[model samples]
Target: MSLQVTTIMLAVDDMDRSKQFYKELGASLGQDFPQFASFELAGGSALGIYPLAHAAADAGVPADGSGFRGVSFHHIVDGPEAVDKTIATAVAAGATIVRAAESAGWGGYFGYIADPDGHLWKIAAA
Candidate 1:
Protein backbone atom coordinates (compact mmCIF):
# COMPACT_ATOMS: atom_id res chain seq x y z
CA MET A 1 0.00 0.00 0.00
CA SER A 2 1.21 3.49 -0.73
CA LEU A 3 0.77 5.94 2.12
CA GLN A 4 0.45 9.67 1.74
CA VAL A 5 -0.03 12.43 4.29
CA THR A 6 -2.25 15.32 3.33
CA THR A 7 -3.01 16.68 6.76
CA ILE A 8 -1.33 17.07 10.14
CA MET A 9 -3.39 17.53 13.26
CA LEU A 10 -2.04 19.12 16.41
CA ALA A 11 -3.55 19.00 19.89
CA VAL A 12 -3.46 22.50 21.27
CA ASP A 13 -4.51 23.89 24.62
CA ASP A 14 -5.66 27.11 23.01
CA MET A 15 -7.02 26.95 19.49
CA ASP A 16 -7.11 30.68 18.93
CA ARG A 17 -3.46 31.11 19.89
CA SER A 18 -2.34 28.22 17.71
CA LYS A 19 -4.41 29.44 14.80
CA GLN A 20 -2.93 32.92 15.06
CA PHE A 21 0.60 31.56 15.15
CA TYR A 22 0.16 29.45 12.01
CA LYS A 23 -1.49 32.39 10.28
CA GLU A 24 1.60 34.47 10.97
CA LEU A 25 3.66 31.72 9.37
CA GLY A 26 1.64 32.24 6.13
CA ALA A 27 -0.95 29.48 6.35
CA SER A 28 -4.37 30.47 5.08
CA LEU A 29 -7.31 29.72 7.27
CA GLY A 30 -9.67 27.03 6.10
CA GLN A 31 -12.53 25.75 8.27
CA ASP A 32 -12.89 27.39 11.66
CA PHE A 33 -14.77 26.10 14.68
CA PRO A 34 -14.61 26.37 18.43
CA GLN A 35 -13.00 22.98 18.90
CA PHE A 36 -11.08 22.82 15.65
CA ALA A 37 -9.41 24.95 13.00
CA SER A 38 -7.85 24.01 9.68
CA PHE A 39 -5.24 25.81 7.64
CA GLU A 40 -4.10 25.25 4.09
CA LEU A 41 -0.38 24.94 3.67
CA ALA A 42 1.99 24.81 0.74
CA GLY A 43 1.87 21.85 -1.63
CA GLY A 44 -1.80 21.25 -0.84
CA SER A 45 -1.04 19.87 2.58
CA ALA A 46 -3.16 21.03 5.49
CA LEU A 47 -2.71 21.60 9.20
CA GLY A 48 -5.43 21.05 11.76
CA ILE A 49 -5.57 22.32 15.31
CA TYR A 50 -7.96 20.94 17.86
CA PRO A 51 -8.54 21.23 21.57
CA LEU A 52 -6.03 19.12 23.45
CA ALA A 53 -8.56 17.71 25.86
CA HIS A 54 -10.95 16.75 23.11
CA ALA A 55 -8.23 15.23 21.00
CA ALA A 56 -6.96 13.13 23.84
CA ALA A 57 -10.43 11.97 24.79
CA ASP A 58 -11.22 11.12 21.20
CA ALA A 59 -8.09 9.00 21.01
CA GLY A 60 -8.79 7.47 24.44
CA VAL A 61 -5.60 8.87 25.90
CA PRO A 62 -4.78 11.08 28.85
CA ALA A 63 -4.69 14.79 28.11
CA ASP A 64 -2.04 15.80 30.63
CA GLY A 65 1.44 15.64 29.15
CA SER A 66 4.37 17.87 28.47
CA GLY A 67 7.87 18.20 26.97
CA PHE A 68 9.23 16.90 23.68
CA ARG A 69 6.54 15.13 21.67
CA GLY A 70 9.39 13.55 19.63
CA VAL A 71 8.05 15.02 16.40
CA SER A 72 8.50 18.31 14.58
CA PHE A 73 6.93 20.01 11.59
CA HIS A 74 9.26 21.49 8.99
CA HIS A 75 8.86 24.43 6.68
CA ILE A 76 11.25 24.75 3.75
CA VAL A 77 12.22 28.13 2.40
CA ASP A 78 14.19 29.32 -0.61
CA GLY A 79 17.48 30.07 1.19
CA PRO A 80 19.38 30.70 4.40
CA GLU A 81 18.26 34.34 4.61
CA ALA A 82 14.66 33.24 4.45
CA VAL A 83 15.27 30.87 7.33
CA ASP A 84 16.40 33.76 9.51
CA LYS A 85 13.46 35.90 8.46
CA THR A 86 11.01 33.10 9.20
CA ILE A 87 12.46 32.56 12.63
CA ALA A 88 12.15 36.25 13.42
CA THR A 89 8.57 36.29 12.27
CA ALA A 90 7.64 33.31 14.40
CA VAL A 91 9.19 34.92 17.48
CA ALA A 92 7.23 38.08 16.84
CA ALA A 93 4.10 35.95 16.73
CA GLY A 94 4.82 34.72 20.29
CA ALA A 95 6.74 31.59 19.45
CA THR A 96 9.87 30.74 21.39
CA ILE A 97 13.04 29.99 19.45
CA VAL A 98 14.24 26.55 20.42
CA ARG A 99 17.35 26.98 18.29
CA ALA A 100 18.86 29.94 16.49
CA ALA A 101 19.21 29.76 12.72
CA GLU A 102 22.69 28.74 11.66
CA SER A 103 24.64 26.39 9.42
CA ALA A 104 23.40 22.85 9.63
CA GLY A 105 25.78 19.89 9.66
CA TRP A 106 24.14 18.71 6.46
CA GLY A 107 25.18 21.98 4.74
CA GLY A 108 21.86 23.76 5.12
CA TYR A 109 20.65 26.49 7.42
CA PHE A 110 17.83 25.80 9.87
CA GLY A 111 16.28 26.72 13.17
CA TYR A 112 13.55 25.48 15.50
CA ILE A 113 10.73 27.18 17.33
CA ALA A 114 7.94 26.13 19.65
CA ASP A 115 4.44 27.46 19.23
CA PRO A 116 2.20 28.64 22.05
CA ASP A 117 1.11 25.08 22.72
CA GLY A 118 4.73 23.87 22.51
CA HIS A 119 4.62 22.19 19.13
CA LEU A 120 8.06 22.22 17.51
CA TRP A 121 8.65 23.54 14.03
CA LYS A 122 11.82 23.55 11.97
CA ILE A 123 12.37 26.35 9.49
CA ALA A 124 14.99 25.14 7.05
CA ALA A 125 16.72 26.34 3.91
CA ALA A 126 15.71 24.55 0.82
Candidate 2:
Protein backbone atom coordinates (compact mmCIF):
# COMPACT_ATOMS: atom_id res chain seq x y z
CA MET A 1 0.00 0.00 0.00
CA SER A 2 1.19 3.46 -0.88
CA LEU A 3 1.09 5.88 2.01
CA GLN A 4 0.96 9.64 1.88
CA VAL A 5 1.08 12.05 4.78
CA THR A 6 -1.98 14.25 4.57
CA THR A 7 -1.87 15.85 7.99
CA ILE A 8 0.50 16.50 10.86
CA MET A 9 -0.99 16.96 14.30
CA LEU A 10 0.90 18.65 17.10
CA ALA A 11 0.00 18.47 20.76
CA VAL A 12 -0.07 21.97 22.14
CA ASP A 13 -0.52 23.26 25.65
CA ASP A 14 -2.67 26.15 24.45
CA MET A 15 -4.87 26.00 21.39
CA ASP A 16 -5.19 29.74 20.91
CA ARG A 17 -1.47 30.32 21.12
CA SER A 18 -0.71 27.52 18.69
CA LYS A 19 -3.33 28.75 16.26
CA GLN A 20 -1.99 32.26 16.33
CA PHE A 21 1.57 31.06 15.72
CA TYR A 22 0.64 29.01 12.69
CA LYS A 23 -1.57 31.81 11.41
CA GLU A 24 1.35 34.19 11.60
CA LEU A 25 3.29 31.73 9.47
CA GLY A 26 0.62 32.16 6.73
CA ALA A 27 -1.46 29.04 7.31
CA SER A 28 -5.12 29.66 6.72
CA LEU A 29 -7.31 28.47 9.55
CA GLY A 30 -9.60 25.60 8.76
CA GLN A 31 -11.67 23.77 11.37
CA ASP A 32 -11.46 25.42 14.77
CA PHE A 33 -12.67 23.90 17.99
CA PRO A 34 -11.97 24.29 21.65
CA GLN A 35 -9.74 21.26 21.76
CA PHE A 36 -8.61 21.06 18.18
CA ALA A 37 -7.81 23.27 15.21
CA SER A 38 -6.65 22.61 11.69
CA PHE A 39 -4.90 24.72 9.08
CA GLU A 40 -5.17 24.32 5.36
CA LEU A 41 -1.74 23.93 3.81
CA ALA A 42 -0.41 23.82 0.28
CA GLY A 43 -0.66 20.62 -1.76
CA GLY A 44 -3.87 19.61 -0.02
CA SER A 45 -2.08 18.70 3.20
CA ALA A 46 -3.03 20.00 6.62
CA LEU A 47 -1.60 20.93 9.99
CA GLY A 48 -3.56 20.14 13.11
CA ILE A 49 -3.31 21.45 16.65
CA TYR A 50 -4.85 19.66 19.56
CA PRO A 51 -4.77 19.93 23.31
CA LEU A 52 -1.76 18.14 24.76
CA ALA A 53 -3.73 16.03 27.20
CA HIS A 54 -6.32 15.03 24.66
CA ALA A 55 -3.76 14.22 22.04
CA ALA A 56 -1.88 12.04 24.46
CA ALA A 57 -5.04 10.31 25.54
CA ASP A 58 -5.98 9.63 21.96
CA ALA A 59 -2.65 8.03 21.33
CA GLY A 60 -2.52 6.24 24.70
CA VAL A 61 0.68 8.01 25.70
CA PRO A 62 1.82 10.33 28.42
CA ALA A 63 1.75 14.04 27.73
CA ASP A 64 4.51 15.14 30.09
CA GLY A 65 7.51 14.32 27.95
CA SER A 66 9.82 17.17 27.02
CA GLY A 67 13.04 17.88 25.14
CA PHE A 68 13.54 16.92 21.50
CA ARG A 69 10.96 14.59 20.04
CA GLY A 70 13.33 13.46 17.29
CA VAL A 71 11.09 14.81 14.56
CA SER A 72 10.73 18.13 12.80
CA PHE A 73 8.55 19.83 10.22
CA HIS A 74 10.12 21.33 7.12
CA HIS A 75 9.06 24.40 5.19
CA ILE A 76 10.60 24.84 1.77
CA VAL A 77 10.81 28.25 0.16
CA ASP A 78 11.88 29.49 -3.27
CA GLY A 79 15.32 30.83 -2.40
CA PRO A 80 17.92 31.66 0.24
CA GLU A 81 16.44 35.07 0.94
CA ALA A 82 13.08 33.51 1.49
CA VAL A 83 14.68 31.22 4.05
CA ASP A 84 16.00 34.17 6.05
CA LYS A 85 12.73 36.05 5.69
CA THR A 86 10.73 33.08 6.90
CA ILE A 87 12.95 32.66 9.93
CA ALA A 88 12.60 36.32 10.78
CA THR A 89 8.83 36.10 10.51
CA ALA A 90 8.72 33.12 12.78
CA VAL A 91 10.88 34.84 15.40
CA ALA A 92 8.65 37.90 15.29
CA ALA A 93 5.73 35.60 15.93
CA GLY A 94 7.39 34.27 19.14
CA ALA A 95 9.18 31.30 17.72
CA THR A 96 12.70 30.80 19.08
CA ILE A 97 15.36 30.48 16.42
CA VAL A 98 17.38 27.36 17.04
CA ARG A 99 19.74 28.17 14.18
CA ALA A 100 20.11 31.23 12.02
CA ALA A 101 19.69 30.73 8.30
CA GLU A 102 22.96 29.74 6.69
CA SER A 103 24.43 27.84 3.79
CA ALA A 104 23.85 24.14 4.20
CA GLY A 105 26.43 21.52 3.34
CA TRP A 106 23.86 20.17 0.87
CA GLY A 107 24.20 23.41 -1.16
CA GLY A 108 21.03 25.11 0.15
CA TYR A 109 20.23 27.58 2.87
CA PHE A 110 18.35 26.45 5.97
CA GLY A 111 17.54 27.17 9.58
CA TYR A 112 15.65 25.82 12.55
CA ILE A 113 13.10 27.22 14.95
CA ALA A 114 11.01 25.96 17.81
CA ASP A 115 7.41 26.83 18.36
CA PRO A 116 5.99 27.80 21.72
CA ASP A 117 5.53 24.16 22.57
CA GLY A 118 9.07 23.39 21.50
CA HIS A 119 8.14 21.71 18.26
CA LEU A 120 11.06 22.08 15.87
CA TRP A 121 10.65 23.27 12.30
CA LYS A 122 13.30 23.45 9.63
CA ILE A 123 12.93 26.26 7.10
CA ALA A 124 14.96 25.65 3.97
CA ALA A 125 15.36 26.79 0.40
CA ALA A 126 13.91 24.76 -2.40
Query: Could you say which candidate leads in lDDT?
Result: 2
**Top-TM-score structure, candidate number:** 2
- C-alpha lDDT of all candidate models, in order: 0.91, 0.93
Superposed model 1: Cα runs more than 4 Å off: none
C-alpha root-mean-square deviation, candidate 1: 1.1
lDDT of 1 at 9: 92
Model 1, position 43, has a per-residue lDDT of: 94
User: TM-score per candidate, in order?
Assistant: 0.94, 0.95
Please, what are the lDDT tens digits per residue for candidate 1 over residues 1-126?
A: 999999999999888888889898789999999999999988999999999999999889999888898999888999999999888999999899999889988999999998998889999995
With a 3 Å backbone cut-off (N, CA, C), the pairs that clash in candidate 1 are: none
Model 2 / residue 32 / CA error / Å: 0.7
